[model samples]
Target: MHLFRSMATLVSITGASLILVGCGQKSGQQKETITTSTDSELTTVDPSKTTAVGTFNVLNNVDEGLVRLGKDSRVEPGIATSSTVSKDGKTYTFHLRKNAKWSNGDPVTAHDFVYSWRRTLNPKTASQYGYLFSGIKNADKIQNKKAPVSSLGIKANGDYQLTVTLEQRIPYFKLLMGFPVFFPQDSKTVQKYGSQYGTSAKTQVYNGPFTLTQWTGTNLNWTLKKNPTYWDKKHVKLDNVKFNVTKDPSTGLNLFNENKLDMAQLSATQAKQMKNNKDLISRKQSSNYYIALNQKNKVFKNLKIRQAMSMIINRPMLANKVIGGGAINNDSFVSKDLAVSPKDGSDFTQDVTAPTSMGYHPAEAKQLFKQGLQEVGRKSLHFTLLNSDTYDQKQLSEYLQSALEKLPGLHVTLNNIPGRVILSRQADHQFQATVANWFADFSDPITFLNILTSTNPSNISQWKNAEYDRLIDASNNDDGGNAEARWNDMVKAQNLALKDQAIIPLYQSGEKWLVKKSVKGVIYNTAGANYNFKDASVK
Candidate 1:
């Protein structure tokens, strides 16, 4: 599940200058286009429907929300020039930038924001990100089909001001505004295109720094042309940004070497080979990669089986040798450096009170697997491991398949599918086991913890623990105002999940990329969309 959300411009590690090859136009002038590659294909540009990082990254560039992420993941003005908060922190009023206009020449008004929020919260829309609107007044009721979408606590105060009411204060509400899911959509365009909206480049309109072009309903490549109509277009320097879907690291590296791409991500093997390359830029992500077993499967229903599965994989070796780069093994679902304890200022992962569940112990794992098989009235176990068709994911899946098969009488098969298909299947609970990634939408442990709640759409595994749910609920509502108490509740919830082996937390992502020195000002966020090209330029 590419379930997400921010960030700063990337600086070179070795201070080496790389060159970006600019495409030449018919006029003989070089176009400032920064060519990049993503391993996954874009599913949709619709903010409401996006679940994959590729979709969110595309939407992040082609759309504008109330606020946009700036350097260091700070909230900066977007369509909204300024905002004011009520003393209770439940009411937020945003003053829209009067000059902002959509690509279609319609003024970007407060009504657009109001309409967008209501549309996403509408049960008929079936937005997976709807869970993110939990604290908004009437949002939960609407999502649960108990209230009408119109009852959502948001209104357009005239044409240039929007007011939002929340049932309770959300600590990361401001950060959420910068996420593509919270961006405003054009009501007229959406209504005109109906369900076809966002299926292709021409079906949607843009109000951000760039306008998408050259994208068919399904294509391997696309372009984001600078939006002349953008309110802040003056600050957007790149004339065009080109993207290609390159699933293989070898292909991406070749593209980079051939000067066809400004940036290319490296595989663990490639990262090792390029360790001394000045262009090698390594980024530690606030994201977690884990294996989620579907509880509906009989073999996985046994506690011992689940624990044994986690124990079988050598996570440290996976992170250090196999995944390599700067990847780190983790025991808890919440990635480190994501949040700090309000009480002691320690990293959230440092205070986990649970026993280590991620350690590799083949002997204990084999014994437990044998017992689990007998308990389940089976002599052998077999299941498919679903994963994305990217090189890195394929490698990880292969490693898991080889490791899990080490358990006696356990046969594992790999089902590598497109990223879009994986998202769809994961949402529908169509797999027995899947490799999933969670990119934090904000700098909070709750972003990772709350997703495992029994009712959350992101909880594809259907893992449920009443105490875990209670702790998460308390953290969000009862102890939300008390920072220390909320932190404690989240800590307990994380430890509970780890102790239960709810999911096999593998590693925190440490992606290495070969970026051209000529590309500058691109904002790279570890947690969310990962890239923002608004201020980016090809020098």
Candidate 2:
């Protein structure tokens, strides 16, 4: 499950987007005279928002969920010490920590989850992740304006026990609970701050391992200081965790080389160049990169054209030469190695597989293009491939543009924009096609695959199949269905998604990162995404 393109990460943009630095400075102006050991070009810091790097760093040292993802990527008790679910996996009863209190010295309770979920789905929050909870009973109805917030399937059994009822059986529901959107909010704080809640460090209180020190509302750089109130404070060892936004891979690498940045993404060229370095480490993250066609658009309506697009490119070469060698050839929308593969703990030994049609053959691509042109009664066509303007994405998009033009009737245009603008276009459906990668918030295929499908609320690609939708509905409705049989149905749905050619499946994802080996307790879960730093301590 890819989040932030791999593990469970979410960075949906809203009104004003700023890269949150894990510091207490609102302007991200740090104590310049302090003995700062790392270096980078982190310009702004805001509390209202955070970058992928900032979110993860803050997750462990600052934000505390009812439960947290352990360093092993498995679920462990957070504020809640233990939880019990009904036999059918429909209702979850959580036993919250009696002494677990917020930074404000307020006790955290089950109602926090209820309030957070409702606030996220409140229509006004406009949380794109609100759809992530659609599977919850009444969630869809409330989000769709078909029901009331009170009807949401959660009840506060007294104050400590949160009894949650899902719409159907979700074997992986517990893992989903560990995602960021599901994290609890302070009711009093949210109401008092209103729109300003979650917008700044001063406005928010810490319940996790670290507390936000100096981040302003604008995101750029910030730090996480040890939280004295953390129940398990003894297990957290880092005196402070700093976050810097390194959007440009080359610049990030430069800073890393200069010893200004401890960790950063390497350019494909930089990664290859540094492959032999003592500090470089590559991980096959649970994420995939691919294009999504807005089926509602006429250009994407023809399957042949879609197939033609898929067949023209050489994915393997792109992975090795353009996107960085560590990127797996992701032809399947879901990471084949996602979730803890029962067959093996490692992704290489996982049971996940790509779609049958996920392949590249120049001859096949040309043939599909010809067929598509004939269907549309056109000899040639033009379209643009939209992508985020980041360095790696630019290289990847440009490479695809050159490759796709191999087909005689195709004229591909590359449209790259800032991250903020790209997110806007995706939400507003302003482009014909987009190169987007989805990450999972939990260790389940549905978390990634289902959202890309045509019937999904987040399905910007407008294609829909009755059979595909039916199968998903069936899986969710299966109360006593055999587990193996359920898997068969899921495969059927994924296969149908492939068969429609509505969206092209690229290679499954692999994570790649560079870390200072001294940082221990950063657990890596092969199932869902995200690095758990709850117990991680710097040597």
Candidate 3:
């Protein structure tokens, strides 16, 4: 079934209203709780296997790694209480907090992390995020099946001591540890559930501030209850967190008006209409949304055709006129707020300029399109454009179709499906072109640039450039210890990708929401899960 329709049905449920029941304070007790809505349903609960935003939201509360994002986006100790790096910056040793324990009453030790990391790096796991572990010694070899998983550079010196070796210096390694991919998993629980692990709440174990319940793997509603076993439970004020999957803007607004939800994500139109509302808030996310043209398609393989397609879209109009509320037009694939130049400390986006071919020019686009058609011996070109079925995605796809169809002899057909279906289709290379977005896993340019490499599983475009690959390799391996040299290499690689029109960048997303004034202390990170409710409270 299409996920959008399923979510709509879930949101339409009346009577009983689980939101009130879940968020209400118990009798004679002063407890805080929150009711919120996500744009879509969660795709997975397993930390190592998930790539969806909704899934990350749940995992951030139910599981944790060596470090976690604290209030105000500060890095705080989680399983590990302290850590030290070698003088060469190639080795790190962590001392685990002995008080940490899983929800099932099992101790969370360094061995759990070793087991989890090896599982994620194993080729049998088929994790798309395996590329994230590249800098760890032997990680690439393990992913390529050239070395055994046991050979990966992680060791449990004792129950509380964990040591890690790296091939080169990674300035953002601490930040990377806060991501879900690096979280630990219980070996016994994983073996007990076998393939069913993390498919539903029943098959998962929690080691963080909350425990998931009532998730049937296909439902649109779920509940998060405070985990009494959490090591840092004293700081967790929320007794429960109720989440409802909402796809329609009208429904979310109605829920917010009815006081059934403490926070609701708003559409651009809704934000404009309710701009005067005191509860309205806007969050500028560090993310990039773009269109990925599959180079496997014969028509898309032409460089002039790709450049023409990219140049025809008016990004400013899309960001301001179509989707307002502070959404910024982006000429490059890397987000504006992602990172800074190591040499000058200036924002990465400000330090680099996009290639001329990526700029908007209708006349030049028409001429290039005509030349491309002549070169490919075609009078007209037609291709399907794939996107999610959410309200915003539908609008974005329609806008693209209208703009691209204005070019002579070019036709675009949009296929709007469920979010899950769109992800599967992209991974399988089932579309000629598609609109997609990438949220950075860490605060670095390599987090965005590494995905487009030829061997990275996330490169759905099937674009392979020898020079681009060489630059990325050098940034990660050869000059990784030299921050300035690594930054220059990455910038050159991004420029080359733009010159070749690897992808057409549209705009960086801006999150708009209506949040209750009583809620406080929710941490919003520039990378990873985006939200952390560990210290959240409602008065």
Candidate 4:
């Protein structure tokens, strides 16, 4: 569910220096590449690997999905030109445009979807993301090896009509389709190349607006040439998108100053320095940064300790001091500004849960810790908090360690590991409490809440409330996704989650990035995946 949009150049998202050099001969001079961070180390772009900045940054242009999210956060056609839903909402049929073709000029067909889903769910493939498709028929059973892959709920009626069936009603189904998990794959290419398929540009084929060119499996740079077979070939304007990974902020900034990088991520210091500047592009997203307590631990199971931990942290200090102004202290697990109003603009959620406690309050936090300790009959508590080893994660972890110790009886230990390791440990439920962040896979509340269900593979925290799960189920089924009723169900769900205090909400993200003035048509979207490089252009 960790879907990527923009590629970061350095470890830090905020502005860094650029170090990765561009690839291919200089045919026509264009604007420089955009890095999500200001870092200076260069990393290679590989399409098969899941990377935030790399895939969507430049190499993503060559990849074709069934549907693409447009600048308006609306579902737009990609491989499939049009689709229709059943009156019961259980069946969705799509019509693939006749002209859509792979980079090899072979027609991309509905069977591609059928083949791809089976491939991703093939237990031998061991794709961790197979759970995202559980809403489809027999997906869970297949992933669990209880059923064969053929039972998956996708059918190719012809060269054009791709039909899908859900286990039940799902509201964000379209948004799920917009995700890369559901994108089609050419059966022949994948079978022929075996393990080497999609590892390099030459090994794979394209059907989107761009055709990838000149990327070896380990190359730090890649180029995407426009695909003439795109359905809307006329509107697919950019000739190609070139990407290079730069891992240092200072060097990235140097490139920015020299007009080489078109856009870059800013560091806390950099954002603080440039926030008010006209060139800074800041966006507040519907993402919540929080700490997930593994309830399996006897110490963490104590509500008193949970409440104490929640109360003591200074959220505003982190927002104001470390994160700067683009972030706001969050109370509800779901970030504000996401589906706050109905399509017709009416309030949906009633503020039933106590407002999220954000900002620094050492005194009250110490008192709560004392109260919790006394109630639990414990003289002191010890626990390790895990986080990803990224700079932001380390920064946040260190700050939390200092803040939590101020509480007399609470001693916090910090462990910073690779993001992949962090994810693995989390899935294994191997920590006391961990800093967890979620970027929405789609534009629905269910996208955030449903994944935390007791049975979900991604439910790493093992925090489950039957009532909360029920509400989420209602939102996905009866309420019909992103609806006012669904939002109401979400408000109810978050309130219940707060009442249980299984997790603490910290701050919401403000989608902040510094884009040099010359970049255009980056295909930015507020919801779902944020950017598409296919249409990106440099003037």
CA lDDT of every candidate: 0.79, 0.62, 0.79, 0.63
For residues 1-539, write the lDDT of model 1, one tens digit per residue: 26311001110000000111222122125457777665556667888876666667677888999999987788999999999999989999999999998999999999988888888888888887798888889998998999999999999999999999998888889988988888888999999999999999998999999999999978877888999899998888888877776667788788778877767777788998999999888776777788889998877878889988998999889998877757898777888888888888899999997464578899999998899999999999889998766666678888999999999999999998776677778889999998877777777888789889998888878998999999998988878778988898998898889888888888776777888878888887766666688988766
Model 2: runs farther than 4 Å from truth?
1-57, 340-357, 479-481, 526-529
- Say which prediction, candidate 3 or candidate 4, comes out ahead on lDDT: 3
RMSD of 4: 4.5
User: Model 3 — which ten-residue stretch has the worst lDDT?
Assistant: 10-19
Would you give me the overall lDDT of model 1? 0.79
**Candidate 1 backbone clash number:** 2
lDDT of 4: 0.63
Off by over 4 Å in 3: 1-28
For all candidates, the clash counts are: 2, 56, 0, 38
Residue-level lDDT of model 4, residues 449-483, one tens digit each, is 76667776556678877888888767756676446
Q: Which residue pairs in candidate 3 have backbone atoms (N, alpha carbon, C) closer than 3 angstroms, thus clashing?
A: none
Model 4: residue 456 alpha-carbon error in angstroms:
1.5
TM-scores for the candidates? 0.94, 0.85, 0.94, 0.83
